[model samples]
Target: MALAVCVLFDARTERRIRELWARLESRGVHTLATHTHGRHHPHLSYAVLREWDLEAVHQAVDRLPDGGPFTLTCQGTLAFPRGRAALAPSLTAELARRQESVVAAVRATGADLHRNYAEGAWVPHVSLATRAPGALLPVVVAAVADVLPMPLVVNRAALVDSGTGETVVLPRIP
Candidate 1:
């Protein structure tokens, strides 16, 4: 199980993502919509912890200054190794700095950060398919292209349990 500091999408963006998930599912592709625990919310994670003291991680993140709402324009599709597919968001300096800050704060709590989430190494993405095979890249790409240049409004931040989808909603977008 992992815990992540995530920035959640606004209602319209969330609904659009969910609709995309349904479309992907109808095409025989697996998505977060029906992944593991089946309660995933549409989000982009700042830092994912492989190991952490829940309360400590939460407190560490909660202490960060509120970054407030921002927008991420997903302009392309990303097919990572191991059949993972996602939407590649056009990053801004503000997004990068916010992610770095969150990573640093979580690390300060002695949390074991997922290597992929390490500051400069991080690629901001909104996951679409969890196990799409290479043969299916075109399908994933086509579906994502339909939503290209999609602007995702990030209006909330929370500490989410990856396994169970349990969330500890933070007061501000941090």
Candidate 2:
């Protein structure tokens, strides 16, 4: 099972993203919307652990900074070669620094990290659809294009189990 350190958005932002997901789902486009035990939340993952000891990870990250409801500007849609499309957020220096800290803290626990999340390799995004059909790309793009440069408030952080969609640890982000 994979564990992810994710920054969750506020209710308003969550609703906006869910609305987009609904639009995609209506078109039969597969997305995280129905994945992860059907409990997926709109979030920007900072790091993903391939292996981890739950308690150890919690202790390691508990001491890290959990500041404001930072604003993330979603520039536009970005697609992966594997048929996944996501909202690309402009990475601010502060977001990068926080992500680095999370990676460091998780690594300190001796957990195996996903290479894609390694310091310089991470790409911050809020996934919109996966396994999307080529025929549906234009539809998906058109649905979200008007929402470009969307602003979202990330006010919480959590350690989520990718397998069960359970929140393993939710540290209070001040």
Candidate 3:
């Protein structure tokens, strides 16, 4: 199972994202809302690990600063090379630094990090659809355009088991 470090949204933002997911699902677009585990939540991942020492990862991450809370502005739609479509966010300096810090802390644990999530390579996004067909791109974009520049507050972070939907580490970002 893959493990991920993610920044979770506040309740209002989470609700909005879930609502967007419902709209996309109605348009025949597959999304994390219907993920197999049935426990998917809207999140922006800082890193994903292919392999790891669980205890070591926990210890390392626990030592990093909470970085407090910050707001992310979703500006527009972004398409990944693998046919995934997401809401792209403005990567502010604070957000970039926080993410880079998380990457560093997680990497120090000897975990194999996903290259896409490495410090300089990470793309900040909240996924809207997976395997979205080329023809459906415009539809998806139109569905979410009115909500462009959505502001989401990152108030908490966690280490989750992607396969099982279990939170292994929940750091209180006070």
Best by TM-score: 1
For each candidate in the order shown, give its overall lDDT on alpha carbons.
0.93, 0.86, 0.85
Error of 1 at 130 (Å): 0.4
Per-candidate count of clashing residue pairs (backbone under 3 Å): 0, 0, 0
lDDT of 3 by residue, 1-174 (tens): 798888888999999999999999998988899877868879999889999988888888888866778888998999887668999999888888888887888888889999999867899989888778899998789978979879988878888888989885476541
Off by over 4 Å in 3: none
Clashing residue pairs, backbone N/CA/C < 3 A, model 2: none
- The pairs that clash in candidate 1 are none
Give residue 29's error in model 2 in angstroms: 1.0
**Which candidate leads the pack in lDDT?**
1
lDDT of 1 at 86: 92
Worst lDDT 10-window in candidate 1: 54-63
Q: TM-score of predicted model 2?
A: 0.94
TM-score, cand. 1 vs. native:
0.98
lDDT of 1 by residue, 1-174 (tens): 999999998999999999999999999999999899999999999999999999898888889999899898999998899889999998888999999999999999999999999967899999999999999889999999988889999999999999889998899887
TM-score of each: 0.98, 0.94, 0.95
Worst 10 residues of 2 by lDDT: 165-174
